[model samples]
Target: MRRAMTDQLSGRLVEGGHRLDVRVYFEDTDFSGVVYHARYLHFLERGRTDFLRLHGIGHRALMDGAFGEPMAFAVRRMEIEFLRPARIDDVLQVETRTALLGGARVVLDQRILRDGEVLVEAAVKVAVISPDGRPRRMPPAVAERLGAPAS
Candidate 1:
């Protein structure tokens, strides 16, 4: 059973390009002892952080860099589907992949899974913005890292 479980997850991880492991805590649970719906968004955020890190773009560095432009990313929209319940103490893996990229926005496909079962899936759209809060074209370096063509 354990071997089958590992194989299933491994296959999914490969399909997603990368995987981030996160263990749900008490704070993430609700009155029913299952992970609160909002907490799934937090899990997805963590996954995005790890995904950027893997591509060598840390949030801190982006916020404080030679660009000195004080860049920030805003979630313009998100479509989420909760298929299963996750409980406290459950170790979930978040898979993130870039599905689409536009001049000023990116579409990310993220999923939370446990033991081969998908618990949640989300389509997150984020826009790159300047410190003044105006949407801007993604920096070439960041775009290239994300597999987006450099402008």
Candidate 2:
């Protein structure tokens, strides 16, 4: 039997956090054969997205007016620390956990690891916004599903 699309793309929730596995391809590497700094951001983003999906929240639905208006998440700020370098053909795991959730903002702590060794760490703050870009609070049902307090 074919697996569901979400099953194939979503990560598992572990210990109140999410874990997504990512493989580094040639294109994700720089001239020195190490993962490009910016590519780590892509991996981290995927982990966060999948984390939300696993909780029954999807970006498409948000943008499709699921909550009275088309909405999206915008990264308000991010602090990243590059600890070790990842090489081509390496499989990395991205771990993400919600650190804080507010009416219109969510903060997440993310880490990239290879074989249990930390490679990168990041703290991300994202704001929920309407399509027009104004800040908006997340729906109560959505927040509750995500284990966050609804404002």
Candidate 3:
């Protein structure tokens, strides 16, 4: 399919968020052949990472002080719900959206779906921190870029 032929590595930015296509691998499952519970976190992380990447935010650049003083994004909290199991070889779509973004914190809503069925969902809270691990207010420009209302 033409759609499948594009950007096989990472997903693109959608109207209000990001959608990434991920294929379940053998390693993602346990002996029962269902995806391991912990594995869902990895999938969620990838979606969030790629969401920022597509939005022009890079980890390396952040550490290099691209936005101002060197800083990094760190997960402060996460609440996940595993609704269904996904077997190996299943194609999953990880959707990520910014629920709230301001000052030094961001709350992201992420969902993992298989054929439009939600398999897992999460509410992730991330904090902006300095290299020394102290919380810091995100730079204004960076916040503006990420906090912009989705079209």
Candidate 4:
């Protein structure tokens, strides 16, 4: 069912990425009702998380060492741009795609859009780490799965 079940709650894996629809609630906005800039990070994070989940590389399994050694993913860097503001009640789509994959990190490009108009864009770098927070090489199976197509 590749890219065919966007109506699912967790969103769906698209042809080249993942798509999630998020509602702009009052709590996601500020005093003026515009979405808070920081909140966009959460939306983007969820997109990435779900993307990995759909790719069969869930964080819970990785942290539980289902890949053979316990590890976690952490944001190493993020470059974001706010193109426009979203107000309450708006339904925004967050799109996420893998831009790069390395031995110990993955770079993702994300965007938030309303009615097909891009409102925000971001480039995020995520690193694999051990339970002690030390940097570590991404497990081979994990990297392979990330580079491979979704089932």
Considering only N, C-alpha and C atoms within 3 Å, which residue pairs clash in candidate 4? none
Give RMSD (Å) of candidate 3 vs. truth.
Answer: 3.5
Model 1: per-residue lDDT, tens digit, 21-83? 888999999987899999999999988876876676777887785344668778999999999
48: Cα error in model 1, Å: 0.6
The TM-score, computed over Cα atoms with residue i paired to residue i, of candidate 1 is 0.83
User: lDDT by residue for model 4 over 43-85, one digit each (tens)?
Assistant: 9988988888888888889989999899999999999999999
Query: What C-alpha lDDT values do all the predictions have?
Result: 0.81, 0.89, 0.89, 0.89
TM-score to native of every candidate shown: 0.83, 0.92, 0.92, 0.91
Model 2, residue 102: distance off in Å is 0.4
Once fitted onto the true fold, the runs of candidate 4 whose alpha carbons sit more than 4 angstroms away are 1-7, 148-151
lDDT of 2 at 97: 86
Off by over 4 Å in 1: 1-16, 66-69, 148-151
**Superposition TM-score, candidate 2 onto the true structure:** 0.92
